[model samples]
Target: MIRTESLTKRFGPVVAVDSVSLHVREGDRYGFLGPNGSGKTTLVRMLLGLVYPTSGTIEVMGRRMPARAAEVLPEVGSLIEGPAAYPYLSGRRNLSLIDAIGSRDKRSARRARIENVLGQVGLAGVDERPVKAYSLGMRQRLGLAAALLREPRLLILDEPTNGLDPQGIREIRDLLTELNKAGTTVFLSSHLLSEVEQLCTRVGVVDRGKLVLEEELTALRAPTGRILVESPDADKITGILNGRLVSRAGEHIVVEHEDAAELNAWLVGEGMRIASITPERRSLEEVVLAATGPGADRLDR
Candidate 1:
């Protein structure tokens, strides 16, 4: 649904996006990730033609950008930065203005379409409230409602859950999942790693204005025989397990060759005290940090 080739953006001495190539397939709940100043927003701006690329190409829905921006934007929905609304306007009025921007009129078909989206984003109960009165989470929902006004084929969201509480965040997460399940392609950027771990199928990690790693979530989470053994005598435990494939990682002994049962039996038989034994998975945060930290360019999927 989206593709970029050697895409770069520059501001004199600094490059905001650098030769980043990415592919977001149809129906993919794609997660774009990086810390502040990593150029995720700049990259998305270039894709939306809000900023022109320094070099290279961007394609959305098979149409090249900057050239076909007008033709293509209608089919793409985006919520960048944050929700913007006329503070004096009521929530319903806010949506009516968005409806005016597009040629399609959902007015006749929807209980005004405004109501449908308000309900979709869980704002129907307060649809008549003034924009100034809505909470930040409510405003975020309003932004999503505006994006959905035209029933777009592709949704581009940056920080979709920015102001949401736990429940609101879960609601948005479930909404995105349902939208993807119903055939809408979702491309979202977020600083929330746990959210991405639960919601996204594919991930792109960017750093220092460069794309460092792009991989399926399943592939990025490598399976391992690394079981964690935590005890006060972790050092002594590692010495005992050294005959097997074992290594010390902080206060834990990571046993590679022995299963939990074998390791526990050996520990008890050797008269060593044991605290807990558990299998460990390399977390997505670790993978992301390794990819986007110093020397990020050296990493790959």
Candidate 2:
């Protein structure tokens, strides 16, 4: 649903976003990942046409960006940096005002739509308390409700779970998953590897303003010709596969093998009682760290 080719943005002499190409297909829960100041926000802004790129092109839903933002943005929902609201106004009032802008929906249905999104984001019980009285998590939920107000075909979220507790985070995750399953394409940008690992189908890693790696989550997490085994007869197995054994810690062992099933069958055939055997795969954390450098927030001497 979104595509960018060598898209770049420069602030004076600093290139906040270098030549980066991004692809987010329809119905994809694509995770755009990078550490602080790695150009994730900058790139997201460029995609939404909020920040003009220094060069290159952006296309959303088959239409060129900035030029076609008016035509295309209506179908795209985004939460960038963080959400904003009139602090003195109640959340409901704030939403009512936002829902009226450039919205073609019938006025009669506006209240129901607002209430539906508020409930979706876990703010259904929110009172008439002004936004200044709401907690950080509440504000985050308000932002999400605003994004869902229109039920856009594409969602672009940045640090979507920034201020929530675990339960809130899980709720939002489930909501996004449900939306994606129902055919809303999601482009999620965040520094949280675990969250992305659990929610995203595909991932792109950016480092120092450059796109470094792009791959399907399954492909990136493929088994690496190794097996983890837990057996009561650990010593016996170790002795039999001494050359192939990578490590042994009591009953748990790591073996260098290409096929886990064959090894399991061979062990069973040899009358070695087995407890468990499974192929070892790289975690998402390892893959992302290898692709990106230290975050910009880190200082080195």
Candidate 3:
């Protein structure tokens, strides 16, 4: 439950965020994607009231942001950059400290909550270890546990998968899925398209400080007809198809088309015997780049 209207932010002469609008429905796992310096973090900070917008309106969980940030923020948990923890403190101690800051119910209850989240993040038995000794993945999990200490209705995560190995990433991904399934709204900002493609129900793409695309992840990843044909006379088939040949794997040819059946029929009508034909679907990354155009190359910076 988040909404923004004409959200704009500036740093003197440079506008970091420009007239952007976004919406996330309740219980939605929404991904906010943009390249470096595209203002994704700036927009997230504005939503959290950590930074004030130059001009715009923000409503989070039905409460207007900035004006009621104090009241509204209590219902939200966020990790803006990386995990913040006391290096000298044990992981359990770090969580206990956060619980105290959030005014959790009681010492025992807070400890229990911390343990529960730590376990959820796959750090069950390592709580006694000092944070300084923990790996980057462990620290990330610890940060997630701290964020969940408050049991907020909304979770804002920035690059939660950063520094995580494949196993750690899967664990965090599963945790987020469970949270969303339990009705906690997630607004995740990430540079990893693969992570977003796997976790988000919907996505918003930004580039050059502008909102360029927004859509349901399923729609964006819808299957498209792609055919891989292998024949002795690949050149003859390519000429008959009148379509651009994408690539060749040995004697096979990959061609993208809107209708596979039509292409097959055309080939058969031309008296060409097809050895094999396999269909393929476009991926989320491909669709995103297509929608945003060639400018996607600019996102790396």
In order of appearance, the predictions have TM-scores of 0.86, 0.96, 0.86
The number of clashing residue pairs in model 3 is 0
Per-residue lDDT for 28 in model 2? 95
Candidate 1 per-residue lDDT over residues 100-122, each given as its tens digit: 77555556754468889988998
How high a TM-score does candidate 2 get?
0.96
Off by over 4 Å in 1: 104-106, 229-242, 245-253, 258-278, 294-301
Query: Global lDDT of each model?
Result: 0.87, 0.92, 0.85
| Model 3 per-residue lDDT tens digits across residues 1-301 | 9999999999999999999999889989999987677889999999999999999899998989999998998789898889999999999998887788748387788878888988988888884668999888888888888888788899999999888999889989999999989889999999789989899999998887889888898887665656778887787877765656787766798887766678778788888877877676667777767755445346563
Per-residue lDDT of candidate 2, residues 1-301 (tens digit): 8889999999999998899998889999999998788899999988888899999899999999989999998898889888899999999999999999987878779999999999999999999999999998999999999999889999999999999999999999999999999989999998778899999999998898999999999999999999999999898999899599999899999999999999999999988988999999999999988998877888881
The parts of candidate 2 lying over 4 Å away from their true place are none
The superposed Cα distance between candidate 1 and the true structure at residue 269, in angstroms, equals: 11
Error of 1 at 178 (Å): 0.7
TM-score of structure candidate 1:
0.86
Q: If ranked by lDDT, best first, what sequence of candidates would result? A: 2, 1, 3
